[model samples]
Target: MSDISSFGATAKGLAKNPIGIIALFIVLIYGFAALTLGFNPKLEFWERVPLVWFLVLFPVAVLALFGWLVSQHHEKLYAPSDFRTDDIFLKKSQISEKREADFQASNEELDRKILEIVNRLSKEQLEPEKIAKQVAKEVKDATTFIVDGRAFLGRPDAVFTYPIAAFETLGALTDEVYFKLSKSVRPFQYGTTWVLRNESTGDVIRTLRMLTATPPGQPLTDIRTLREVGIHPGNTLVVEPPPC
Candidate 1:
């Protein structure tokens, strides 16, 4: 009875995500079809050929259709408006120049903030609150940094560079801080020792080095959920360089 209840809860949890529901539906359909084909000893040669063909082709077609639907949904959700034409007529050179200028300015500002945090860490007296404030002020986008030698930064309007599952896991670590930051930011690389500090107390909560490509069913120590990390509210998270 207890085992059945636990299985029911697991199924219910999986059903909550549309992707999971779709995947489970596909698996059940395929499994049922396979079982039916295998058990039906009365199937004629012609019938078996067509049935086998249908079974093979149907799932591929369904998966392709699902992919197309997801792509269309993402474009609609995140694509910029085509209605705006103010800069449509601008020359390519002019647009490039403007973008480069903005990128440089943003990069400079980020560098300054990183340096400030480094200096603060070097001090004999470490104030977690001050460190957190400095980081919160500078890190407006939490999705731009490199993790474990892989770049997670995507286009300005992109939902994510990696799988949504990975992002959800990372978000679990960052908590509310992920929501506060912009979804878009300039991409940058970092060393292996990068740590996420509590914005208010400056205590190390997570180490980004643990964010490697973890296999399914494996635990990601660096990207563990907030509950797993045991972080409480009022703790703003900031990415920092390796300790000196």
Candidate 2:
């Protein structure tokens, strides 16, 4: 999830306008000043220096200017406050996402162990269905199944993935899952449309144009209708213009 965009997303963010790009040269200016200082270690280096205080004060002034440039145009160049998805904060998102993925993987592994036990019991002339029902009583909080939604945005053609719970609906896919995917596309509900297509056949399975969050029983985003529309795992959702 942290690999949110292609290379140069940060560069593009800073390149929005001329004023925002001044910060890029800060390091170059400092590098040139250091080269100008020469490599002499003479004892009279301090006294013989021309305006020695410029060395001390100039760096502070340059850093302050850099901070000012970032602050002024941050709204246009940075992610929203909630996501903190600028390049600097992307590492935090990566760490958090790794932890969540590990936790979900652990949950799925536990479910697999239970199924293994059921298979072993069935071989012993015992009723597996009856025992499986008993086992299903536990760990029933909707974490047992996960669906991979390989999603791509139209304009940039950048591909990203979102995990869909087996029980999640179309409304939840956008309003909850995709919304948390990136702050750059926040508030994705307005006039937003999705095309769910078969990965092999390249056929359109479903189309959802959500005006509101998933309602309680709307057919548009219903997970229960997956069988009716031939939706399965690894289906792709293309934003806007669908696909060829």
Candidate 3:
């Protein structure tokens, strides 16, 4: 959820006329000065220096510095409040090349698996049922599964669950999951899911929100159907399930 209440109307009103808003603030400050100082034209330079330069400029400098500090500290926050993302590119790049190469190699393997699945389904003789059997069998044999490109998946014993199903029979992959919404589907509903997996381990590392709400009855099958609803098939939702 976003904090729209404080920002929406205020931003809207300010956006309508930026110059007018600035002018209004200036007028308020001028009015306050007139009431306090009352047109003192003949004051000495020392007195005028205190009033004009020290009092005004000192406060303005302090305010400018304060604003700069706040911006530096709060740069992570954006409009709509709750919407934020981590900027860790520099930090990631600082890691050793060996580690980066390893991650890339894993990603390539995940891609190979996705291509394999798609190619298998495209075969003329194979239908959804066969695909499900093959996929499940393959998953059972393999240590992990790649879902979309965001998450990595591998079966792990209980006590190692860092995320959803960490201890459950459901496997964990090595991909990083990201939560995002899709606008490609119609009649939007919540609980849409997407996954990202490491290319090598076929592990799901990332899970994202699909645009649609959960479908009643059984979970959806076929990546194309998820896309039809404006969600991506990816690796996780792309697989076929046993028929009801």
Candidate 4:
């Protein structure tokens, strides 16, 4: 049904245009002139040719030239439209813009919360007790749990897990103890604990252990019965008397 409508529309458009009518007339006239020239020797022979030959040939040549000219004009008018409706270019641009806006909005909100946390921590002395209080205040609606690795100084055997997104923002929690406690520098690993230094003392005595799982099913506190608990810190032991 749609194809029939499209065909009717095309026919109507062609019927309304003078160029199509004129082209048809020129073709008919050119055909007649060709037939007349074939039989009429007086029109064809240069020496005895009649004025009608020039008259018919001139008009046919002019109309033929106009047909080509009209086609070129039509082509130029419609050519630029080919790229305007491209789905990959225009649609992809819209998708990219939407994603960029969403990302920026999310980053702005996250940054605001991070600034508040950093500002509160900056005002207080860097201590385990105060940091915990600040964390509780800042991260609203998040499940908060504490892992106490009391023996980080001796064996570096504490394990923790935390959300990677939150960790990415906070960067590495560094303190004086981490720099001064041991000459060794252990890189943070996934599903493993790394010592968090007391920012004030640079001591690895008590490190903040994170539960690194995304669904965060890993135990934040050491579960002696569960072997698949949170990852253990490299070269460190979780002290019995947890700091938290």
Model 4: per-residue lDDT, tens digit, 1-244? 9997986676555455555555556655666766676766665456336546565577878867887877755432222224456753554455445435544554565567667777778787678677777666555422222333435445554334332122211222222223333344333321233444433333433222443343222323221211112221121222232234
How does candidate 2 score on lDDT?
A: 0.48
The digit string of per-residue lDDT tens for model 2 on 1-244 reads 4564742576566655554466545544665656566554552766536535666777789778768866764434433343544743664444445445655664676578667766766776677677767556434422332222334432343554443333233445445444533543434332333444455566654434432445323444333223334443344544432344
lDDT of each: 0.49, 0.48, 0.38, 0.43
Cα lDDT of model 3 by residue, 79-119, tens digit:
32223434333322332243344445545655676568768
Superposition error at 51 for model 3 (Å): 3.9
List pairs with backbone clashes in candidate 2: 170-221
Residue 204, candidate 2: Cα error in Å is 3.3
> Which has the higher TM-score value, candidate number 3 or candidate number 4?
3
Candidate no. 3 TM-score:
0.25
**Candidate numbers sorted by TM-score from highest down:** 1, 2, 3, 4
- Lowest lDDT 10-mer window, candidate 1? 184-193
What's each prediction's TM-score? 0.29, 0.25, 0.25, 0.20
Q: Per the 3 Å backbone cut-off, how many clashing residue pairs does candidate 3 have?
A: 48
What local lDDT score does residue 97 receive in model 3, on the 0 to 100 scale? 40
The most accurate candidate by lDDT is 1
Q: For residues 102-187, could you state the per-residue lDDT of candidate 1 as single tens digits? A: 45555676677678776876584667787777577546432143222112232343232221123323334343333323252211
